[model samples]
Target: MTNVTYKYATVLVAIQNLRNEGYNVDFNLEENCLICGDNKYTIDDFEIEQVYRYEGESNPSDEATVYGIASKDGLKGILVTAYGAYTDSMSTAMLRKLALKND
Candidate 1:
């Protein structure tokens, strides 16, 4: 993973910036993997290239994170997820994979 710090005004802006840089695919979190269209990728199939987090000014529900992910097969994509109280439920492995970076 790239250990560079990037600052964006909002999660949308971060996603847009990543999209412009060739991370076009949109990935949704599944119980044990990330899904993009018909393709499913496990943690071992992809790497987190970058991560951007946004904390709400007032409501904790507004907290979110944007991830730049790249698959071993050359697929590049973005994954947007909520944190704290609104986090998605997933398998233990999936949670560990994402939570490690979240910290």
Candidate 2:
């Protein structure tokens, strides 16, 4: 994947920009999949297209990441997740998949 950085001042701005770019869905991270409405997308069903990370100035708890995701079937969305201290728990495959672009 190509490396790209967006200059959105905050996580909210990044989300809005991605929405305007056609990523209309909102994906929730699951233990081994991503949930969008009633649909559950496994690791093999999607790819991370872009990642935007925000770090807090005073506290680590404010750290968060916004991911631009696209499924094989053409569905596009964004996943907003906390990093650092309050990270979510997930399967190894799910962690690896997300970590690929996060790093």
Candidate 3:
């Protein structure tokens, strides 16, 4: 597994460590996929290789998650998001695919 093996004290540390290990690109969620700059990848075209979730001891606002995403065409990146009550504003088909992946 290419997952980060050590426990990072914070989200920032985890991101920096992951980047140092080559998960350099940053991804944004799209309607039916993930996008990094002009490049896009559909649900079936990319995989979430690893996931890391962090929560603050005193504040829910500090919740965050990081996803290691890799595309079939060889692009590698990370997607950072808020943890609780977050919603994916994508089509039903795309949403279903992502949901199944989480399970």
What are the lDDT figures for the candidates, one per model? Answer: 0.81, 0.82, 0.72
Stretches > 4 Å off in candidate 2: 2-6, 84-88, 100-103
User: Per-residue alpha-carbon lDDT of model 1 for 13-61, expressed as tens digits?
Assistant: 9999999999999989876889899989987999888888788899878
Which stretches in model 3 have alpha-carbon errors above 4 Å?
Answer: 1-6, 84-88, 91-103
TM-score of 1: 0.87
- Superposing every Cα of model 3 onto the true structure, what RMSD results? 3.3
What are the per-residue Cα lDDT tens digits for candidate 3 across 1-103? 2343337777788788778878889988876678999988887888777667787789988887777778888887888877533364777765554442323
By lDDT: ranked, best first: 2, 1, 3
Steric clashes per prediction: 0, 0, 0
